[model samples]
Target: MTMEPIGTWHGVTTDELGCVTHLELQDNRLAGEIPPELGSLSSLVRLELTQNWLSGGIPAELGNLKNLFSLSLSINQLTGPIPAKLGGLSRLFTLYLGFNQLTGEIPPELGNLTNLNGLFLAHNDLTGHIPGSIGNLEGLEFLALQGNMLGGEVPPELGRLADLRHLSLANNRLTGRIPSTIGNLEKLLDLELEHNMLGGEIPPELGNLANLRSFSTRGNDFVGCIPAGLRTAALNDLAELGLSYCT
Candidate 1:
């Protein structure tokens, strides 16, 4: 068998109609931007290019793939907003686009991907609020949106996602009270909401998150005491529930 391209020039060897099922180019010194032509591969399922030096925006043509399941492009230098066309990927499960220079709002169109599981868009320059459409993701498990400039209230619709387990929304400029509907997320285990401008009472409904183990909200503008139920109920792991600057 001929030697396969292993390190930097891996994707360069990918041929059209090569029937590749899994393409993992993560952390192999792959530099430069992703080729837009790769979208022609209709058979691709898992495509991982994380932890590389890849730059430039993700190609909008990637939406052409109707069978892609996992798409990982994290820890790269990719810039520009996520393409709304990516919403065409209905079967996608995991989407990792963190640690980049991506800007603009979280696309509401992404909510069309009802099969999505892990949605990682943290450590970028993204702005705007969490889209209410995200509640349409009935299968989402992990959602990370920290270290950005996202504003606006936590969409109450997010509480509709019964499968959500991890949610991170710290270090942003978000305002408004914590949506009481969040208490409906019984599967949530880790919830982070620190360093924001949110105010108003902590919703009593959150006390219903019995699966919640870690909750943080430091340096916020919240007023009134902690939710009575949270201070005394199943969520009373006070040490693990770091709170600060509540009015």
Candidate 2:
């Protein structure tokens, strides 16, 4: 219960915390680590230590916080890896390290945070592949690398995330097929490639995802049937369609 040391004590008021610039200590049960002098708070901009119980390993001096833009260390109990100097926080736009216990890989320098729009590394224990420099994060719009233990395939350069909208590589250990340039993510809406080891068939150009809403490929190794434009009506905002244990 003696946490102090965030910055400028002696009577508070940089809005009750001294020279503050948005530092939300989420779920405040804050534990340890994460104080490399808070990277000298070079005018921080949104740093929320999420759902506390924090452990160590995320302070590569926070890349000297060149004006951070939303960095939430998700549900803590942190582990290693993931600090490729936080890609030097080039004005990061929301980077939440999901449900912690993090491991290696996934840091192709976080694709140099091209004004990233939400990139949460799901669950954790991440492995390799998936970082074709994350297709240089073309203004990414919510991409959770589901569960984790990620394998290859699926990165048809993430179809160049033209403002992607929720694309989870479910479970993990991904395999081949499914990337017909992912129908160019026409603003995709929830497309989790169910438990991995994927196989051929299913990409009828993802029925040109007319803003698909939740489309899982079930336990993969797909074989056929289901791609009738993802069962017509241009996916009519389909609500959770998992191709039950594909043939």
The C-alpha TM-scores of every prediction are 0.88, 0.35
Q: Candidates' lDDT values, in order? A: 0.84, 0.80
- Worst lDDT run of 10 residues, candidate 2, spans 237-246
Position 134, candidate 2: lDDT: 84
What are the clash counts of all predictions, listed in order?
Answer: 1, 1
- Tens digits of lDDT, candidate 1, 47-107: 8999999999999989988899989999999999999998989999999999999999999
Q: Which candidate has the highest TM-score of all?
A: 1
Error of 1 at 39 (Å): 0.4
lDDT by residue for model 2 (29-91), tens: 979888888888777788888999989788888888888898999999899888888887999
